[model samples]
Target: MLIGKIENWTKERNYAHPVIRRAIDFLDETDFSLLEDGKYPIWGDDMYARIMTIDAKPRAEQSAEKHERFLDIHYLLNGEETIGWQSLACGAEPVRPYEEEQDYALYGALSEESLQAMKPGMYMVLLPDDIHRPGLSETGASVIRKVVVKVDKELL
Candidate 1:
């Protein structure tokens, strides 16, 4: 997992991962206000960005999830969000089986879980091995708008 500010990424464009660098470029170049809430293709099926608004809830109300085929860049647009994350290596039982079509799996409580406070200027990169629960409320904020860019693991 990686956490970074949009400004920092702009200043330091030489990210080690080419795909992640392209994802950051997508965020940096687009005018998000012009687009509606939906999926937008970047590099066809291998990469796309989903823009949506979610009602932030408490962390306990959410389930930790990890992806198999795709990695995610959770780029915040507006409002505050708190995300709980832990390594899948920490060991947790899956509450639901993995759905290959969706590339997601839900897990119960995770060990060594920690929270990350997210704001509009920041983005988090979540890998296949990262168990994450996003959009948890921060300071009682209700709504959060974010662009989740999904990149196929094959691109790594």
Candidate 2:
């Protein structure tokens, strides 16, 4: 998870995957001036999770990916979004990989077990082991800022 101050982000990445570590560095150094106006999608990969900006809104139903690992770098620049996540240990099993998206795996069923409320300047990191259901509302839509950086598992 990307908690604490920005200065420590680099140090924290030393232990994270190499791809993720480099992605984090890239995100940290980039200027978020464009976000001041509204939410924007920075980068995304169809193979993995769909990386994009989710304006303040209620959490939506998501088919959590399984097997393959994931790297979710959620950066909140404006409002807040309550991100839901569950573990395979407590959630449902994963389905076989589909050719449509090899980076993602289908899940059986799931229940909410963990929640992370993120706001401006706040961010979180989710690994493939983490089944996150993002874009939930806590107090309704409120101008939210965000950025998603997609990373490949091979690099991690």
Best by lDDT: 1
Q: How displaced is residue 56 in candidate 1, in Å? A: 0.6
Q: For candidate 1, give the lDDT of residue 94.
A: 83
lDDT of each: 0.90, 0.59
Which stretches of model 2 miss by more than 4 angstroms? 1-7, 34-53, 60-70, 93-99, 102-109
lDDT of 2 by residue, 84-113 (tens): 778756746665553444556665346655
Please give the lDDT score at residue 21 for candidate 2. 60
Weakest 10 consecutive residues, lDDT, candidate 2?
42-51
lDDT of 1: 0.90
Per-residue lDDT value at 50 in model 1 = 99
Scored against the true structure, residue 30 in model 2 reaches a CA lDDT of 68
